[model samples]
Target: MQTTDPQGSVPSDVPEPPPHADEPRKLEARLTDADRVYRAVVSSGAAATLLLITLIGVFLLIGAWPALKEAGFSFLTEKVWTPDGQPPRFGVAAMMFGTFVSAVVAMAITVPVAVCTSLFINEYAPRAVRRSLTSLVDLMAAIPSLIFAIWGLFFLVPALAPIEDWVVAQFGGWLPLAEASATGGSLFNAGLIVACMTIPITTSIIREVLAQAPRHECEGALALGGTRWGMITSVVLPFGKGGIIGGSMLGLGRALGETLAATLILSIAFEIKPRILENGGITVASGIAIEFRDAKEMGLSALMAAGLALFIVTFAINFLAAMVVSRSRSGAST
Candidate 1:
């Protein structure tokens, strides 16, 4: 029952606490404080990542200033990297060419193989075999680049020699890329090694993405008198296309930055050449790895500039990949 309190005010069984309330207010205040702390931590993490990249760019630009001042654009255009010469003529044209070309070759090999393998694993493989094969792929990803480099040097190079020779015999007369020099460390060989390295990563990514492809859509297609192949073509492939593209681009990014394998697999060269089979190729990372130890003054600066170039290339590739992925996103209206 209601009753009059102090003067004429009515009071009920449940009454509001005074301003001095303890536990509830304290808990609410604590929750708010914790939320603010969490936000600050997350914001700091993002800000730190951005700051680190900016700092790296600053350092590279500052270090490369002397070389950029003297050489101007020749550092980019010329095809020589002689630090000991009279004029100390150095250029990254050959390295940049090799980097892009070999990465392209790797992508060419990796994309199709990865896509096919991933499809089989995700769509067709029996459950028992699927787990085993996926585990094997994960094992491959865990394998060190040094191990791949050694295997490429001792085994793959020799094994591919016969194939290279045959291709040269058949197509060397017209197709420059198919032309093979006897040197085992040709760009083609390096590219193959790079492909091998990229495959596991690409396949894993594709498989994961493809696994998420709408199962009901696939079933719907199959229900409409579609064969397995027809269903995949009409439903699965379309759904996974963006994922496949994104995975391929990620693999390409890895290939572009690959240092140890590329360095060990390719015979570093200073001049640019059209033949992909040539023994002379030097990727940017490989260039830095091989040159950094011996570099002094301008040479160091040149290496810095080269590093900057690779950074720009990687950033651009990632940016473009993001655009491609966004454009190709499933369920999005064009």
Candidate 2:
């Protein structure tokens, strides 16, 4: 047996161990001051945003308090809105109904087409075609709201006349919607115009969200011999459902606040009724637009109350969207 030295077993060139096991922790400790500054900046930004929203809500409430106190809760339920005489009174029921109906109709039209268009752009269209279409959609989106209003007034409204006429001729006896005349502007026209207005926004948001779908999921579906449609319906759509709902709600919110085009297109009456074809219906925004010039002092406050109502509606929608997004992130993490 050969004698082996312990010193020979260890390499002479071996380096000493690192100073401490928690060296990384020490380095991080040194960064505490910088981390504190960063956290302060983030907290300040969040506080600023909260402050701004709070100020807005407070201002709206202050402006609306007189009308709200006088009318009580019946302001929401009452149909009459005359503010000119003694003991001035106003109500938002008709405006509320019109706003809801038009928004609903717009969403009904926009959601399907937008989702389909986004799906096609994301999964079906060739890359070159998708690029071109996406550019066109973006261009359409960038067009000013006023321009859309003008174009709808001149072009789309007229173009829709024949289609409206045909629908009335074919379905008039069966449905109340079909009773609407082709020439005059109506709820159907305003709803359709709003739908058109929202199409680009909805399509763009849905496309971006769907494009962010997990690549591996899609690949796995394809590998499993799933058809393109089947893969989209099952994998892509389920993944994007939350985003889609959020986008739809945002679009609906836009429709609710739309003023110029809706005012120009929809026949505005103060009374509430169900006939979409009826000569008069006015959304809250449009009502404000139409009546603001002639409104007296209390009437002005009444309009502000409606504006406050719209603001609350939109804020609620955004809050709901945030909740949906949070839930989606949690589900994805799990």
Candidate 3:
């Protein structure tokens, strides 16, 4: 029976009917076994990812041991990469330089174009055309890198030769990387190919992220009498900064490891060149691709060492990119 107040009426604050009989049991189930099991499963997946990365590092280190032992510390500092000589002297100084320059060039060209393309699809395109533009960018990412390599080697190089020559003739002396060969297969040319390969993927990634920007923020900006460009500058750009950074870095990784494009186009010089367009620089991936076919024993080990260095560099870069993405997702900026 229900309790009553001073009179015969039921108490003003009636009990809440003792919650449903099954509610407490359901609540307990969620807080105990179910929650713990879900947490453990997610944690294990993350741990597995880290373990795989560690195993890869260990394997590369072991594979590279022979060259390291033979060359000592000089393997890193020395510029020579002649692995077939008697007593075999080798180093990756040149490949490292080429890797840096080519990847930098690729990122510089790819990032701006990708950002603009993504913004166009996400912010400015007609609604009917948005899907089509996005699909076009997605299609480009699926094109084989081999196709890009072949096109760059035969058609693209020859077509761009005249323009490259003019740049070399006019600014080669004053600008650091303005030098291009008559054939147009310089470090810059290879970088351009890599940029083309990267842009589609980068644009796709950025457009996807920008699509997630809060709708209210966008509408509010326009309602405040902001122009389209003003809305982008004040609202969309800030909102998608993390997506932009993450996509660009992923594109950088592609540029770093591009093999056939660089190998087929570069003159494969053994030293750093200030002029980006001059004949040949040997990037790590291209070096491995070119020499792996003929490498034997010690030569093989030396190539493994170069490959390992590339792995380390790419790993560090990706790790930093992940951190930046994290900051962006958490709404932090600095």
Candidate 4:
């Protein structure tokens, strides 16, 4: 039986009832004036960014319409580029091929190096040197593209010629792609330069992602008798996979639009050049850069069309990359 104190209806042994048992708690935070102002500012910034992107797309479309109408679908398929001709015929086929090929080659070289560099910085570097190394890598990205172009043109192109020749000699018979008639200035050289340009940015992204891998999981793996390398493979690599992909794609986009280095390193040719080691390839960005000064009205329109294609492709790649990153462990998607 419930006991009652002398001065109270119920004894102290009875638990007190909770306040507002039937009412729902306010889950949302109450916005103050400052919070409202902040939200409004952020919303305006986002809206402005979207408006700018829309304006750019509209501009490109308007500028490209004349060329697209003149060439029709053949604008995509034809291999020749002679927009200033009497009838004005041109196509992005070969230039687009070069763009993709060079970008792919750059990624092929950049990804492994970036991944290794990031892993080293995050997991293997000495604490004393880590900060310095990270700063150095980041500083590399701030260097101008024109500097890289000039360096590649004057130094890198000549230095790579011997190596390119050796490769061609070793594999020319069995690997058709390894053969080259001229190795001084080629798509391969452009790709190498672009890869160098892309490495720092890609590595920075990957390092940040890898650094964010759950420390507890890494410790757990080690506690379970896994080696450091094993722990890294099991914990870090898996955690940063999405970031790696995202970083690589971002690098690819950079490589695709790289104008100066490619223009300086590549010997332009209109035909499709599957042999990257040969001294003949041209990318869309380089094409536009080279033709812009001398281009007539039709040529300018054709160049704009090419730029539109590249813009669309780059946008798609980065969009997909953002989606991938958002789905991964490292993304703050919310």
Candidate whose lDDT is highest: 4
Clashes within 3 Å, all models in order = 0, 0, 1, 0
Of models 1 and 4, which has the larger lDDT? 4
Instruction: List candidate 3 stretches off by more than 4 Å.
Output: 1-48, 180-183, 330-334
Better of 1 and 2 by TM-score: 1
Clashes of 4: 0
Q: Worst ten-residue run, lDDT, model 4?
A: 325-334
The residue-level lDDT of candidate 4 at 208 comes to 86
lDDT of each: 0.85, 0.81, 0.85, 0.89
Q: Report the number of the highest-TM-score candidate.
A: 4
Ten consecutive residues with minimal summed lDDT in candidate 3?
22-31
Better of 2 and 4 by TM-score: 4
Pairwise lDDT winner, candidates 2 and 4: 4
**What TM-score goes with each of the models?**
0.88, 0.85, 0.85, 0.88
TM-score of 3: 0.85
For model 4, residues 208-302, the per-residue Cα lDDT tens digits are: 88899889989999999999999989888888888899889888889999999889888888778668898898899999999899999999999
Residue pairs with clashing backbones, model 2: none
Clashing pairs in 1: none
Is candidate 3 or 4 superior in lDDT?
4
